[model samples]
Target: MDRTQYLQQFVDETGWYNSIVLGLILPEWIWRPLPFPLQSWLRNYIGGSLLYLVSGFLWCFYIYYLKRNAYIPKDSIPSYRAMKLQIIVAMKAMPWYSALPTLSEYMVESGWSKCFSTISEVGWPMYMVYLLTYLVLCEFGIYWMHRELHDIKPLYKHLHATHHIYNKQNTLSPFAGLAFHPLDGILQAIPHVICLFVIPTHFMTHVILLFCEAIWTANIHDCIHGKVWPVMGAGYHTIHHTTYRHNYGHYTIWMDWLFGTLRDPEDNYKKGE
Candidate 1:
């Protein structure tokens, strides 16, 4: 085959780039013994939950240990009693909220996702397609839903407001990440469940996305500074929580920019001036 054809074939063969990455991280041999259905469930339940726990703990360590002495805005910090109360309330409801996604995953399976044999036969291209397609739908779904939560007065006051308690001028914390009223948490997560029924999503693809999201939620709430361009890192999300009226998009700010809600961090700095 000519060079162009060779490159095209190679790209097409491995199920796209993400499949290659998945294969390296979790080879076929690792999954061969279990049924795909079981694997899917396990990824959502055991693996995904584990990732959330680890990611949450790490962020807590960073806040309480690494950044304890770092400069934080005085106005942003909550009272010690308030912080403790928020953590207590959030921890109480977090387990149930975490399990809801697993229930949705179990029910959302369809022929669109590859079976075990199909994954081996189709190789990498399948997952790459799954990853790309799902990422778009996931982001779009969450962005709109999240923004709506803010727009609806009762919804924000009763459910989402529990989360915003941490959104003080600059006093966000890691444990504050999962500190949402159960109803509010489910509403934010509805997009993820919706995509499963509508799109052809691979099981592993679902697990990976959910895993990344667990970390992303915590990372954004911690308000530790950093940026990843189109990706909505801590800086972008921090602006969202602190201001309460802007930067509603998740995963990326492209939607925020498109929707005219994207607040520049420079603007946040200028607010002080």
Candidate 2:
């Protein structure tokens, strides 16, 4: 083979220049079992995780394209300093959270652990119900969470203030909670996390759950303004940040109306619109 052919073969084998933006690297990070006997369990779990990673990578590119087009704004976003602080805070809290005792403790501790445990305990068939159940729960859970943080005096000054710093919601900021107070990321992520433990299922559901989270959330941050109906895609959340105290669900529009938190009920929400 010529030099060019040889070089091409090396690159193909190495996956060099393989790039996925905002893609999850969690699978690569999974803790593999040791001593050569029990590693198969990890391989199975890791395979599912890798599937999530691939979907997440594509979603990242979609968001990046949107960001560049100004469909999502990239300006007035977090500074590196703020981003680093947000990450550091989350890292410090994860270990403390995983080791905590009791479901209630999880609730009081990290939002991530609390939710994940909830879903896990619900067990199989009931776990299948989690997506529907959580979709319902999150509307009130997050809306109220967001509103209370802003309206309650102590919470406003202490927790929710940092996230409100964003001037626009057009860009897909994975670090939306980057500099979040340790308590804040949990508040944001845990609701869904707790739902994870509340129900149980096999690997496929786990994979689906991961993708649902990344894609849906990216769309939430994709709109220029919180447009209602047909554009449910970004409007609700945009409205939340724009006005505060209204429109609080991530996946469904029903809870907002039920709770009177719905900003515009007559608005016809159309998908991919």
Q: How much lDDT does each candidate structure score?
A: 0.64, 0.46
Which stretch of 10 consecutive residues in model 1 shows the poorest summed lDDT?
109-118
Instruction: Supply candidate 1's per-residue lDDT for 113.
Output: 24
| TM-score of model 2 (CA atoms) | 0.51
List TM-scores for all candidates, in order.
Answer: 0.72, 0.51
Which TM-score value belongs to model 1? 0.72
What's the true lDDT of residue 71 in model 2? 50
Candidate 1 residue runs with Cα over 4 Å from true position: 1-54, 70-83, 109-118, 121-123
Best by lDDT: 1
Clashing pairs in 1: 14-124, 14-125, 15-124, 15-125, 15-126, 16-125, 76-170
